[model samples]
Target chain A: MPRLINRHPGRGPALMLGLVPFIVLIFAYLLGSHVRLAANPDDKLLPTPSTLMSTLHTYAAEEDVRSGQVLFWVDTMASLERILIALVLSASIGLAFGLAIGALPVVRAALAPFVAVVSMIPPLAILPILFIVLGLGEVAKIALMTLGIAPVIVRDLALRAAELPSEQLIKAQTLGASSWQLVTRVILPQMWPRLIDSLRLSMGCAWLFLIAAEAIASTEGLGYRIFLVRRYLAMDVILPYVAWITLLAFLMDWALKILRSRAFPWTDMSR
Target chain B: MARVTVKGLWKRYGDTVVLENINLDFADHEFVTIVGASGCGKTTFLRILLGMEQPSKGRLLIDGEPVSPEPGPDRGIVFQRYSLFPHLTVLGNLILGLELRRSRVLGKLFGARRREAIVRAESILEAVGLAGARDRYPAQLSGGMQQRLSIAQSVIGEPRILLLDEPFGALDPGITADMHKLILDLWAANAMTIFMVTHDLKEGFELGTRLLVFDKLRHDPQAPEAYGAKVTYDIPLRRLKNDRERQRLAIVEASGSEPSYAPAG
Candidate 1:
């Protein structure tokens, strides 16, 4: 038999092992829910799977009497729109600021310290300020998410750009590359995968900011729905909504990973 | 082809002097190899010639005109590593120089011009023995193949002068022999004046028509930065051809008693 340290599972066995924790957690939750429902038939803290499924069916299939639209789909769409817009805005701001600050010494001198300080400020602390300045609208929510993550992306990409080997830049210059050409031809191509990676990392923060802003002010969103239903002890609705959000986040992260590998195959070998 | 002339060149970073009072002249199509100890400013000299660096005092002239402070396509360089852009395939790396030279804004070409660039790139890739790997990224290549692509990337522009900074220092000894042959063939075919800085004295002597040795003449124990290196021995090896014993003696004498040549930075 192999020693414990040396013993390693094959790919098939390793994937099987990865599912063990999820299976155990689900089994434990089902047992707890059964016990709770047996003790109190009207218990709402841990709803049985049937109750949860029925609630999901009602929210997803039935339109609200007044809204004339399905609340579940409406909430998901509103949340997706806000997060996607915020992500695009943050990525553009990050890429443009990061490359300028990293590639040009003058830009670094002028803005690096300011960016450093900005990144240090707690983004959530200024929620009220943002709401007041940008008003209680979609702009405020998007601004909150963008402000939360753009500085981090800028700092990460700046470090990456600055860490690029000086030899490559010199070689580009010797090939008749001007300043703009150097950035566009040499530095910019290498930063795309890294930018994707930064976006992947910032996804969680973006969702947090999105939910916080929506919980505070929005009329419709996944976060708003969850928060609105919390007063009634609606575990049946909240639990499924939380799971759905997690699945959506997982799919997004997985998509980005696939995009990175397919678009920038060279980065895999670099690691 | 380019004639390079250096007159009283000095490079000092504040209080620390890196190179002091260097003077040399090179005719067109000459292959000069520079060997020195670590931190002796051989790479700095090459950078100056390539116009990536400017001398603190004195002038570097090419064909009787002062070389521009900014690096230009007139000169090409291949470092030991990180010379090829990793994001680009081998052919993409070769075509980039031409595209950058031709199209200033987009740094890209189209139609017939793009086809012409590809043809030029393919031919150079063929010359460098990388025709099979033209579609592969630099990271996918072996060390020796990457170095070949680097050399190809530099030479594709057909610059008048080629600067090599220890281009083979990272390769295996067995692989370096093949590289030496490739570089010699490229040098002869391109007819560009070349200045190569190498840590290996034997490789320098074997490759260069002219050999330069950079060493410091004076040193102060209290202040190590008080002095800088100069070209101590400038030997024309073409005259010493067919004399193996003389070449061996010259290598021994140039290295001196300690011969502790560190890798060039």
Candidate 2:
């Protein structure tokens, strides 16, 4: 009779429970850094919290030597721009292709196999090809990210569109919706939240591609900075940059979840 | 309001026949209820009437013109499920019909027309007893409420015909009874014709002005799919007063021609 173990924990307790793992991770990293740096002051593998803090301050606060801008803000902006552009392109393209594939048999038959083949070819493997074809610019980098994630998005959305109950389509038609109206109203509205969900899922892949592209060839970006300082084994910069990326990804995902719940509250119940 | 005429209709999928030799005339403002056993083509007939399905042979005419094969504003349908768009609220669902028909862009009703649509939708929602649940999503509603919302959504379009395919099949008896009253009231208020498919004999009898039974009169054990269901019995239930009288009409089996009707003695 221990109050049924409080099946639903209070909000404060739940928040604390979520933070426990992060706190443990931070403490473990701090302990490791302490033990390692105590023995070797110049150990580049696990930098001390002081070393990381100084690097963070420099990146975030100080101006760059050449550009007269904060390198951290510049890098963050560059990476974010690519990620956002690539996501918008993929989302629009994926939604269009997915809706076509789902609603039309001919489109599904013709494009499905091509999509499957493209999805199977790893996006990273074709990074050089993208650079070769599109050239080593923002276009190539964005293309790499889009290529990496769009096919999977298309495939997922197509499946979802196909799985949509025929009754809804029929009902819409009976309600005076033309084919175009049906697609825009009935199909598109239903897929909007799912598209956001697909994009949210693809964010991780988007980051991987962005980093890979930036690391290989870029003037300034989060990924480029991480790779740029890696020559001297700048673990302080590398670890914080990685953590920042993780934080950004988590925030984007959380925002999408909130948006989905607020905008399409019926989504969870129907599925 | 529309007159529906089915002439020498036959539906086949591959070699199997689903419905054959279906001929009937549905007058304007008629409350026609179709009842049959499972897979007996009652739903198919309703689908044909809604222009969702095509007969392999013959034709369906609405007001003397061949009804288009594609579903349109002329016919509105309510299925057992997926009747209302889950994403839209009850009020949104009700106004959607007018918005889609009137607005240049779908789901973007605005200005004076939007205000008019809202006013119209609210009145219909009130009529269907869903005034309080206007902003609630269809999923938030009970089965009965969802069906009511769906009916409101359909009727808001002012379609020539409203087709219901076992709309109350999922509801309990009390809710079903309430739905029956609501539907009849809607029918009384609107000028649109109604065609409802149901498995419940009592429901068909109680709600319908005219009753049509679909049954495979010529059963073949060797070639079960050879013969399809037809209009085995067509009864005018407006004259009948009691359950016993309706049951008497229900028992009359089909001859080759459409069954002749007489007032209950």
Summarize candidate 1's per-residue lDDT along B46-99 as a digit string, tens digits.
988888778999999999999988888899999989888989988889899999
Q: Which docking category, incorrect, acceptable, medium or high, applies to candidate 2?
A: acceptable
Whole-model lDDT, model 1: 0.91
Task: Enumerate the chain B TM-scores of all models.
Answer: 0.90, 0.89
Predicted structure 2: clash tally: 0
| TM-score of each predicted structure versus truth | 0.94, 0.89
Mark the regions of model 2 whose C-alpha exceeds 4 Å error after superposition: A1-8, A64-69, A104-106, A265-271, B104-108, B241-265
Clashing pairs in 2: none
- Per-candidate clash tally: 0, 0
The runs of at least 3 residues in candidate 1 whose Cα sits more than 4 Å from the true structure, single-residue gaps closed, are A1-5, B242-265
Tell me the deviation in Å of residue A130 in model 1.
2.2
| Candidate 1 local lDDT, A1-271, one digit each (tens) | 8899999999999999999999999999999999998999999999988899999988999988898889999999999999999999999999999999999999999999999999998889999999999999999999999999999999999999999999999999989999999999999999999999999999999999999999999999999999999999999999999999999899999999999999998898762
